[model samples]
Target: MKRTKKERQQLLQETISENPFITDEELAEKFQVSIQTIRLDRLELSIPELRERIKNVAAKQFEENVKSLSLEEVVGEIIDIETDRYAISIFDVKEEHVFARNAIARGHHLFAQANSLAVAVIDAEVVLTAKASIQYVRPVRLGERVVAKAKVNEISAARTIVEVISSVGNETVFMGTFNMHRSM
Candidate 1:
């Protein structure tokens, strides 16, 4: 049965509240309604779009806490960050990121994404990767969206340890642990 507008709106609010990253298309499919209806419902509820919600959450979480690198230098778009603790970034693999013949992404791109994220999570003005141990678990193809999560496992006055795991969907494609040196 089709849900009444008020009922659907209430359900939509609850769904989005549970998962702010839910897309309008997904909500539309779940509600058995048109995407336009979902958009209208969201607008009426004063809920921002996915991108806006992500930005808002990230800004609120990491505004002044990240001091190591500017946001633009982080290689991928940072979706979440808690300085000196954890960070998450997303990188969309395009044609340029892949090998022309195989359509498999170059390993360096994944490394850069993880490395930059590790650097970005430090709470110091000067941060550098003193060493890293990395492994590629699977081959990522072109057009894949890779999400990298970096968590700081240990921190000292001289150095910090950050572990980064990059995934496509639920499968981990790359993993790395970075030993970072922080100066001041």
Candidate 2:
């Protein structure tokens, strides 16, 4: 018996859903297909590679389990911290961070850096983004290390307003105000 590409893809998706950690080579062997074929099937189904799928699942789990600001890989680290304000760190925009073109850092990465820093400054176990108004003052070029600083501007029982500034060296690149809410 032979299966169509769609059938094979369905089987592959089922196999992946049952055991997401299964290797491509293992899946290929089980499906009697080449590794490249398995990869193509995954791509056709809009499924990420095994590692990426794992990371996605992990990110989802983290989001569900904690209310803290979750920075994606594109945003790097925490460089400095003040009592009510903190600075987040990021490396230059790279191929991985760009979508439409290689020149601009995707907006989500900028948001993540600022939001993460805002959450980091809050004295709470978990924080969630309620709203944000960001202004792209300047485009962040590739290879430019930037810093995002967030300050707690105001606090209420339900929300905290944070002011975030992102700068590359001495040049201000972006700025925003974020509303964060605590889960508990």
Candidate 3:
């Protein structure tokens, strides 16, 4: 069934509110409309684009939550962070991150994405990964987006244990256990 202009706009507002990271192209596909229509609807509704939305959310969340690393120092776009709890980030595998011959992303990029997030979740003035045990489950290809989730498993006066798992969709690409040194 077709929805009226008002109804479509209302639904667009709800959809974008629920998932601010959704792109215009995805909205267009879901609403069965052209990308131009989504853009027009967004303009009329005063909704910013996906990049701006992500930046806005990240900025607000990071200000009060992340303590160890500045936003610019993060290896990827951090979508959520809770100090001494859990945090999540997204890294898009680009051509520069992959080997030219295989188009497979290098392992260090994934490690950095997870390691930075581990540090970001520490509720301390200074934080550093003192030891790490990591496993690479699969090779991520160029253009794949990796979502890294880090959780604080334990915390002591002088150390924190963080578990980080990175995935492309439902499949795990890499996993790491980081022992971080923290100082108040």
Query: Which candidate ranks first by lDDT, i.e. highest?
Result: 3
For residues 1-184, what per-residue lDDT tens digits would candidate 1 score against the true structure? 8789999999999999899889999999999989999999999999999999897777666667877777778788889998888999999999999999999999999999999999989989899999999999999998899999999999988999999999999999999999999998
Screening candidate 3 with a backbone cut-off below 3 angstroms (N, C-alpha, C), the clashing residue pairs are none
When summed lDDT is taken over every stretch of 10 residues in candidate 2, the lowest stretch is 65-74
Give the TM-scores of the predictions, in the order they appear.
0.78, 0.56, 0.79
RMSD of each: 3.9, 11.1, 3.8
What digit string (tens of lDDT, one per residue) describes model 3 on residues 33-103?
Answer: 99999999999999998878987888789987777778999999998887889998999999899988999
Q: Please give the distance, in angstroms, between residue 115's alpha carbon in candidate 1 and its true position after superposition.
A: 0.6
What lDDT score goes with residue 103 in model 1?
A: 99
Q: Candidate 1, which ten residues in sequence have the lowest lDDT sum? A: 55-64
TM-score of 3: 0.79
- TM-score: which is higher, 1 or 3? 3
Query: Cα lDDT of all candidates, in order?
Result: 0.92, 0.74, 0.94
RMSD of 1: 3.9
Residue ranges of candidate 3 with Cα displaced over 4 Å: 1-39
Q: Candidates sorted by lDDT, descending order?
A: 3, 1, 2
Ranking by TM-score: 3, 1, 2
Local accuracy of candidate 2 as per-residue lDDT tens digits, 42-131: 888888887676656645544553235543522556544543445445555677776665567778888777877777667667677888
